[model samples]
Target chain A: MIVSPTRRRLLIGSAATAAAALLGGCDALVDNQHVARVLEGAEALNKDLQRALLSDTTLAREYTEADMSPVFKANGTQHPEGDAYASLLDNGFADWRLTVDGKVDRPLSLSLAELKQLPARTQITRHDCVEGWSAIGKWTGVQLGTVLKTAGLNTDARYAVFHCADKYENTADGQYYESIDLVDAFHPQTILAYTMNDQNLPVAHGAPLRLRVERQLGYKHAKYIMRIEIVDSLKAIGRGRGGFWEDRGYEWYAGI
Target chain B: MFHPRSRSVGKPSSSDVAGATQKKLVFRHPLLVRLTHWMNVLCLFILLLSGLQIFNAHPSLYWGKYGADADPAFIDIRAYRDGNSIRGETRIGSLAIPTTGFLGASEYNGALSVRAFPSWLTIPSYRDLSTGRRWHFFFAWVFVLNGLAYVIYGIAAGHFRRKLVPNTNELAPSHLAHEIADHARLRFPKGDKARHYNTLQKLAYLSVIFVLLPLMVATGLTMSPAMDAAWPWLLDVFGGRQSARTIHFISATLIVGFVFVHVAMVLLSGVWNNLRSMVTGRYAIEVEKHP
Candidate 1:
């Protein structure tokens, strides 16, 4: 039972391949509607691999204030120039109320003051954009899990969908929104951040409130959150995909 | 020197030992070398295509930590609207290169689509970052493992020391100059001289294997947020994640350049022999008479 180094290496490689194959279907995982659909299984496999390797509670890297980038560029749309949004902005978002509904036992609307009074956690974390850039900034907000618990999620609820104030290009269904699974929804760092860098979250950077799923990419952090809707399935969402960008070719799960 | 031709079931002939004038088939690359080489070729191709797909999401390259649509970029490939049509250009600082055919804008299904890299060159052949990422990561695992195996085998078998490292005599300024001059004139080595790597080939192979490949892997890992927690020193080593990405793109470009030159050289200096050497580990080398 002597194995040469090359043979041993090949054995290890094959074992890895076997594990991946077991996790994913060998054949086409999804129909080739989009070429990306073909990789649905691989994405699932990766998700499983990451989950198996690290605990769900494992936190993303937190940096010191000194490590913060001099300038944190506001991503995506800077402002939404609609009358509703304009009036909300003009009044310093005082009239804004984040409605937590959909698949929740208690559908409650909480004002900005009410959210601020809740237990808050301040963190300095890096925002890694899928576009190959990173910036660190201090965020202060209430844990999303706390808010969800207060809202009393229905047993069937599997995902938390965050509806945002910003729109992408003013299309017919232009409301920018994003969602996360329960696993990420209740993660310790997952928060609805209302403040950035000790100041109220600027209009340029998702003023009033923003979803900060630290483990995921910048896109997953839906800005200017208008509603927090817990849903049983993402099938009926925008374009029947999980998120706005996810509908437009981005990965629904951007944990990496 | 263990010619694979001799191992054929038909048996060896007296001609196996040539009379010293004709060509002789030499066992140049080993089984492990060939396997790793081919595997790397596949992985590198997939990685490159998938990487391009990822890059298409934001067709811009920056220097420091923060970069977005607002910030100044060193390289920006953009496709913009004109009167009733669209055109694309790759800008490097002030110089704009019209790269409409292949980059920035390219033909997708007979229609001029604003794709940074054409469909033929991307893994998914469409804008699917998730699928592209999955392909990239899966092949990346293969690439890293294969590379590890290759490096281990090279060290254990003394392949690097024997074949890749330039000897002291070859390192001599006069000899190095001669090698450079020979390569410049497209004059490749033949006969027994061709059996061993020339100084330039040795340098190229060594640099690619030791420097560029490792750098690509490191920079890639550095860009991963998970890896950032695992190995924070990666950020220090490459300045930051964004800087690592910039380095990764540069390294990939260099590797692509290397592959182009490598392929051209293979075609220039006996494609069949070189191909055979890598494939079946048998390279027919010239045997000089009365040398």
Candidate 2:
């Protein structure tokens, strides 16, 4: 009838264990879901601690030309294959239009030249990959904040989901995609990069446009971007997670 | 007095009239030391396992700013096809050594797969980067905090100086050679001499606590992109992010070696006594007989 603090803690722990057992059956590893959940709780703590300790206004370290890597290896899929992508590549992306819809007040579709026509900023920054490699390169593009302002973000929009043309692992439902919260979305260095190394973005490096989230890892920089959708929740996205790699067990907020 | 006061050791009481001496039990480890030691054991165990899991995601070590699939790495662990079967190998640049049961190939889900570092060695025992990172970051905080507590308390209570720092006599080449010779022969000091740490123990403990642990933590922070913006000096100090990672791996490997020797010593000397000293802060000291 009476439960001490330690006893209560034990009871709660056992309850969690029981729930984990039920969920573990669906996963490959035993008790993985429960363990993952607890770990995610810890990750949330880390996220909050980092956000509080780090200023949002602070910029990522900018490098000089000398620091750039001679060859920035293309991460993930280098080139996307398909008739539609082939036609877009043939026209030099002349007819390609990036759709900005979802929770935006004014849904707009802008061409590649139009995005380049906007005020452009170029900076050299290191692209630190989650796979334990890094490469510095000069990226030129319009600030994502500038485009978001022009499109007029709705009051309730919380995240910017990037729909890309790249297909990862042949997931039939859609192409490779990624998302970021408003905090990273408006960061000064967060740009829709259209050029790499003073040249138009190559096919291997996400031609046309790509997201440049300087504060995060390489996977967060969605390549071959086709559309930008503002939304309140990521519940309806790929596997109900933020990005392609995220859905495949990479951290959603990969600041590290 | 049987022993000198300069050594800070208790002299066994003896009366010549009756020729009787009472054996004494000295408090070996303090409560703080015992608590931190056990805490370190748990934290370090989890941190090491989780760290291995994280490393399995990219089983390669490079020495520069940029190193990937195309670039040659100083260390690489991968599984490749050999004839008709898949074989695992660990390569150090041009040298490829078979590591079928360990590094490159491992048993997973009751079947031999291309899992790096084996399943038993990892926390989740599966190829899950997110889960590995979560476990790693969680235990890393615990490990750091436990280390800090041990360090602050060790300095404040003179634990480092009194127990872990070798004096001038112990630091002498002759004395150090003797200690090293004794260690090579599996000989440990007993009675009064066993009451405090030896010169070799002092050096190992000092380096691990003061040097290696901090370097591991610093190099880890340097690998973080966000931390680069917060503290750019980390990159400069380590030369590059990838170099920091290699350093981190080397430091962790050294710590693993330390743990092996530390445990072996504990078992070789007296497992029960050593464990009791760490857990309950009590150890039975061997008494020496004098004529």
Candidate 3:
């Protein structure tokens, strides 16, 4: 059947617009699995690019004492909601034991008390939130290396995973967690801070103890850390990359 | 005409080290340009820092079609869930400068994000969104005016054609491939034209100049409620406010990424020569063979 040119053109235009509308609305335009793959690829490429282009230990520019923002907003869940988390918080986190297990010769579970006893490093570092605010505070905590050494990381271990109690529910099954490479994990300033501004870490500020990997963005500093598992690969963990956040679009290594 | 490849190929740039008379070259970043650049930089820095704070509010890509489920780490997904799927499209609280005019007199809402530090630290309490809007708006003027003046001066002074824009032959597919290879290996060419930007520089600069800056301005305007009163078409232009924000973030990330690459290139392609050109406006060059 012969179609008129004008009618054909109209049909083409309508089809194009319909296709675009479908792209803009329905999930048919692009596959969810493909979307996942693209994100995963971007995540992998970004990690390689970061490692190749950026120095892992290079610190984000330190601001002057004067540049410090007057009010430091506390973001993320202000306080954990679960009863298990509540019990830990109720006891002043004294009973909180940050375990360093997995691929390590000596698996050790140190109480927040024991963590505080180690040789600590204090830095008046600035926390550069991805949200666009900057705050400077004195963070004091034991170096992650001190604990890594205490536990004696296995030669095969490559990444240090921080499993936290904070379950920011996308579902009941998945939980919030993060990880880091050995270099960032062992950097002198990278500590499991128990004190902030000369006080025991407040619940609002990732208490009992929170990570202060002084240089990276705040998310890498996993709050409410329950255990540190040293591993050879991230493949076995959630989504098989690194952190739960890392699994879901956030760069596994968010170096400042 | 001269050799067709001459434009693309090596040029015999003058130098004093060859026992010749001193060379003369002039360039300068005017006060307005410098001020504009610094202001834009400052804006970007703060935006990134504060934006990170709101990432936890929610972490989902509610982009066109293909938008999917959440994978842990995203905040409040279960609370806001429907039909057994969490809406992972926007951050919990939209990324905005929270504390504008309420500075120094505000109390806590009890919302504490590890990354989202309180508005107090960055945005002073009681200082409301009005002040944030001011800094953001005024600085935007600096960005726009500076860009305009730069374009004008760059063209009038031959800086645009001579320094910033790449020659025609550089746009070739083969040339494009080599430039990519060079960028990957960090092997920047050397000479008078070498100090002159390669294809990548031209592409990146042109994209930022013509494409990105405009997007920033458009998106900034689209986000403003006042802008709706001023111009109704902005909503149509960006599709919607949420879409504008998404594009703005994505483009800003691209620009910041470009800055990182640009700086790295400078370090690789003789930091001293590049630094000299930028600071003193005389990029030292390796004179090619005068065959």
Task: For each candidate, give the TM-score of chain B.
Answer: 0.92, 0.90, 0.64
Error of 1 at B62 (Å): 1.2
Candidate 3 lDDT tens digits, B94-132:
442322123211234653222222344332222233223
Better of 2 and 3 by DockQ: 2
- Chain A TM per candidate, in order of listing: 0.86, 0.87, 0.80
Error of 1 at B200 (Å): 2.3
| Pairs clashing within candidate 1 | none
Q: Give the better candidate number (1 or 2) by TM-score.
A: 2
TM-score of each: 0.78, 0.87, 0.48
Model 2 residue A118 lDDT score: 97
Which candidate order results from sorting by TM-score in descending order?
Answer: 2, 1, 3
How many residue pairs clash in each candidate at the backbone level? 0, 0, 46
Superior by DockQ: candidate 1 or candidate 3: 1
Better of 1 and 3 by TM-score: 1
lDDT of 2 by residue, A1-256 (tens): 1234787687569869976763343234424577667667766776677677678877888989997888888987798879898999999999999999999989989999899899998999989888677888999999999999999998999999999988878656456999999998998999999999999999999998999998889999999999999999999988888888888777888877
